[model samples]
Target: MNCRTSLSSWQALTTSSERLKKQHLKTLFDSDSGRFDKFSRHIPGVLFDFSKQLIDDSTFEQLVSLAKESDLAAWRDKMFAGEKINFTEDRAVLHVALRNRANTPILVDGTNVTEQVQSELEKMKGFSERVRSGEWQGYTGKSVKDVVAIGVGGSNLGPQMVTEALSAYADNTLNVHYVSNVDGVQLAQVLKKVEAETTLFVISSKTFTTSETMNNARSSVNWFLESAQDKSAIAKHFVAVSTNLEKTREFGIADENVFTMWDWVGGRFSLWSAIGLPIALYLGYDKFVEVLEGAFEVDEHFKTAEFEQNVPLIMALLSVWNTSFLGHTSQAILPYDQALHMLPAYLQQGEMESNGKHVTFDGQTVPYTTVPIIWGMTGINGQHAFYQCLHQGNVIVPADFIASVEPQVALGKHHDVLLSNFLAQTEAMMAGVNEEQVRNDLQSKGKSEEEINELVAHKIHKGNRPTTSIVLDKVDAKAVGRLIAMYEHKIFCQGIILSVCSFDQWGVELGKGLANNIEAELTEENVAYEHDSSTAGLIAYYKQKRNK
Candidate 1:
């Protein structure tokens, strides 16, 4: 057994798991009238209710002990202090420094990164203001009406998720389009909507060399040059959020138009940096500032709140309890608000990419499951789609149900109806109908005993599926920032508890390197690399068919 599993808290939780497996959440609620009050917490704009999670007071205390034994607080302090905690890369994990609204000086390599973040924020403000106010012009001297954000993975997911979440607040100042897949169809479809002469492209790649991002950037520039008919015009239309100024210069973007990125900020956690330029462009810079402020609030709470009361830490502990102790292998992200429809996809990348490793920080294979298979959709759509599996399927998936108290659009009773479903689903999942309850209901409805018996098994839902409920004030810019920040901190704490290095994604890098080598084999003649027989046969068939 590893050191983590050997901890007193870990052993206690493991010993208690068998009892927890048989205990019903409905029974827990029935025994404690104040269960919700004891289990739920509230911050400024959000209410985090973990009352439905499959745990008792003793279990909760044990989970908190696990966090303490794991040294979560020390790790969090090291990250905030800009120490090189991402030891594999020898870089500091300092996404929190990007939203240091209090302007506290955080140094990395003897230079204050907090000041650097502020400088970049100011630059984003100035540039986004210019674009939104019609001061920034394209090659044709016309104000940019559309913004095309090109990038993949972190660059694409974070900004696009935020923009889509707060899209109702967009002022129609600019229509932002995202092209992440190098599949050509996405970019082709986006390009068809706007004239090249009036559109601005913001290409985001840390090195200006990511394959999908660069390919999409090159194709966009080609389309722009076809219309502008001048190589110099590229400077007026294209901007970049990257550190590689030489590559941006060669690609025809001016030095001033190239924003900055730092090594300390991992791409999955980089939206607070200049990676959020497209967010600022789509929704004015002030709204962007609100996003930062919202995140800063959670950062302060995570830094100061007690472990039992801290929402993010509790989130991490619940996840650990569910996956590591209880043996639940997957969790669902079900948002009742339509504005947060992309939240599942965003978090899938955030959580899975960060903690989807089998090895611990010391390279020991972990005995426990590290991260859950994170998946889900917007609540209404998922109700029709996969809630069947969630409700009746044997695999008991824990879920987070998110909804806002107020709707962004506010049309009549839509918000109430939406919230009603959100409230009812969690209740139904907790207090599922037994065979007796189903039979009683069918008999009350005047169904024959035979009919009731036939339908009873089909309709019977064995409840006790665990879920957490998060209620936001509204799905505005600041709330979106808070929601995402909460999850980000949860992922960080989870990695610490699980003994995995969340900051380094060596898995993603390996696949990227492999794809780069394979690209040459596909495009260049007489350039074949050895592969397994299956892969070799597939490639040979593709090349043979293409030649014909």
Candidate 2:
């Protein structure tokens, strides 16, 4: 389970990959006329075309065998049954329960958690309705006009991405802003756009103690009181989505204004929980429920569909085959729609935070690569920025090309142009230009023999890059929901297949703890402590320069 053992296991799979690589995609397509029919999966309104990936019938059968050997079905059942599969945190990974529309009985510690989830959702609906309908007024007797969501990491990313993706469905009655960075610039720009009397701040943190969020909350409170001149007005303008009722009350938010966040829900997967209050307030409660229903559909598909037909499962298996078995170290998420600009960042956190582990479930080091480095931009933007590297770079990076069959905003010929580029990129990547084609094209362009030789050498593309294209019917609230759920379940399956706990993120804690200690050292004026030479010299230099 150590690094050496993991590397060896991964190395063993390369021989099979090399053999498969020798068989060109053109040959495979010619051999199987129904390649697309055999490789594509249709789930509701989503079409997943994985035919362009570097995979065949034998490769897929082997992946299914790996899933069975890893006991994926049992682990999946344990997760849905409310067992504490996140052993490190000793909590059940039950984000699925948040979208349980069936009201099925799910228990944690002998208490029916399904009831609790339903109750909280009803509460959110009531609150969101009142606020969005102009019934919830500020202390100055004006309806709220703006909502500012304050949270960091998962608390911030998921809702932000969803809201941005489904912006077309937004009611436009109220504007929504999000602040997650500790930097002053983010809050300063947002604060300048709204007045204290009509703005509502939803402070979201599980513990109500995140340093950046609390700091921004304090600064906002100070700015509000300066204008309203009544400290108690904080209760009217600020609400909290947290479990710490004591801290919420102390911060001048009423008990009724404080929503609840359970320990079983993780931040990244919490948009379906109370963390989605901003999303509901911006896009009405009914649209938000549609989002939940969309995800529930994906959840049902994941639970009941066969492995070969399941979209999330197949996506996960493809990722494993590429990263762990084929030695690809990076993955690209290329969304062709411009509205989904933040999706790459959202998936980056979802995948890396969940599966970026070196150890396994039995407290042993893993004997294979865990997670690939996830990075990308919007499809059209990336075509100009990094697609050059993907097409011609030394390392082969697997990519996901996402686009919609119907454009969200259709102008004159713009959507067609965008769709054409989306289709062309994948086709070009799969069937790259060969030497013969390059030479023939150069000759047709009237180039001399010497010029043809030089240009053909540079222009010949070593095709065979692997890519999967996801086509949604449209970019509505429902489609965005299905898209997000697809990737969420994909990360979950990859973690289970790799024999690692995907819910816990202890790696992020170490850095936060170190920052706290460093803050104390930096602020102390008369600090007399033993330090390493490098640290001591840096501190002395800063202090001396500041005194001048």
Candidate 3:
């Protein structure tokens, strides 16, 4: 289907792609001595270096021109202005307003969202401080020392990722745990460790009725009741990050403990909202606000920076050029720092679940490829696992290599080794070893000609795989927030360029709706819905084998 917006960028980028096909990273760097300086830029807490990417000055200009043609600036403004950018859902994509540190008046349906945001922030701060100061008591007159966050998808991933990333900064008294899986093993493990007297459960479902979350919540409620043996204890032990007050009240949460979430904030993008209650409770409320401050700084940068210099816009343009123009179907996110181990999974949902759509804005099937598959692990671990394929594989995979300049905790040259590997991998990816170099090295080692000939192909790496290197000062709360927002804006800009509604996740809903129907059949004597032979056979066999 044809895009409703202008296709001028697509046409011009396609032409530019052909001309830049043979240009490699080595050539680009050699041609311009200031390649790194020209391509790299900074936000408040982070440095983004894209010199390793195969983008030259002429092609870079063309890519920037494409972003302008797609009206990325206007689309970005619409999102920040609370316009209904999520067309299919008819909701304004205003995750940005969740962290409006500037106290800017953003109106949604004639009501200012900042007022509600401020109210919620104050509420979160008070609640956290009360718990930390031993004012908010649990069932057995105990202060909270453990927090169990229960929810699935965005609710679970975002908070869990952030807390884990900032674990270095967390205080000693609080131990945060996350239970999102429907499988009882996860919750059981968490429950076995924490006592009802000291544990506070943060039930975080937007509707307060999500299947996995509610099931887990109910089980936890029953478990809490076992210890207290009184219904009133539930109020002291449970708080919620949900919008449905009636459901939360019914489940025994006090009204004051029910934090707010708005419809405009998508779950995947909800961390900047009160959905980050676990983060506040664990790291203290002030640190939580620092997270928002970091993200807001990037929001200002994306909103005001030119396409040529903007961090998010440059990221999106390079991604579009790699995937849509250069035929790469996947990108790797390799963080050198272990604190960011969850980043790949977090971004997998943030990007793929947003721009993975293949539908145009006018409700027609998209003819061209949209979002690429995003996957990776920590850089050092990946060096041992999948660096083989990345070095000498058939498919061209663009990669982002991330690290911090300063280690959070330095001990025994560990950070030095990690940073060295991080730098070497990108350099090796750009300028892969040739057969002659390998052969010379082998001969210098006194290897026979036969041995040299046999190992040459495996040792030769046809270099020029593109990579982006990003370094932060450190992985503090603000830095983590900045990194997350940078990618979020990149996703938005990518959607604008591709003419797809990045905010609405119809693809995820279709799967959930189908799962609901199949869930009903799981309790039936015989399956009712039509299915392929394999599915029907598997279900029938499971039913027959179960003794229940």
Using lDDT as the measure, the top candidate is 1
Q: In lDDT terms, how accurate is model 2? A: 0.88
Error of 2 at 462 (Å): 0.7
For model 1, how does the per-residue alpha-carbon lDDT over 1-548 read when each residue is reduced to its tens digit?
33499899999999888889989999999999999999999999999999999999999999999999999999999999999999989999999998889999999999998888989999999999988888888877899999999999999999999999989989898899999999999999999999987899999999999999999999998998889999999999999999999999999999999999999999999998999999999988889889999999999999999999999999999999999888899999999988889899999999999999888888899888999999999999999999999999999999999999888997999888888899999999999999999999999999999999799999999999999999999898889889999999999999999999998898999999989988999899788788999988988899899889
Clashing pairs in 3: none
Model 1: CA > 4 A from native: none
1 or 3: which has the higher TM-score? 1
Q: Which candidate is the best by TM-score?
A: 1
TM-score, cand. 3 = 0.97
lDDT over C-alpha atoms for residue 46 of model 1: 99
Arranged by lDDT with the best first, the candidates are 1, 3, 2
Against the true structure, what is every candidate's RMSD? 0.9, 2.3, 1.5
lDDT of 3 at 318: 90
- Count of residue pairs whose backbone atoms collide, per candidate: 0, 0, 0
The 10 consecutive residues of candidate 2 with the worst lDDT sum are: 1-10
Comparison by TM-score, 2 against 3, better one: 3
Positional deviation of residue 281's Cα in model 3 after best superposition, in angstroms: 0.5
Ranking by TM-score: 1, 3, 2
How well does candidate 1 match the true structure, expressed as C-alpha RMSD? 0.9
Off by over 4 Å in 2: 1-15, 524-548
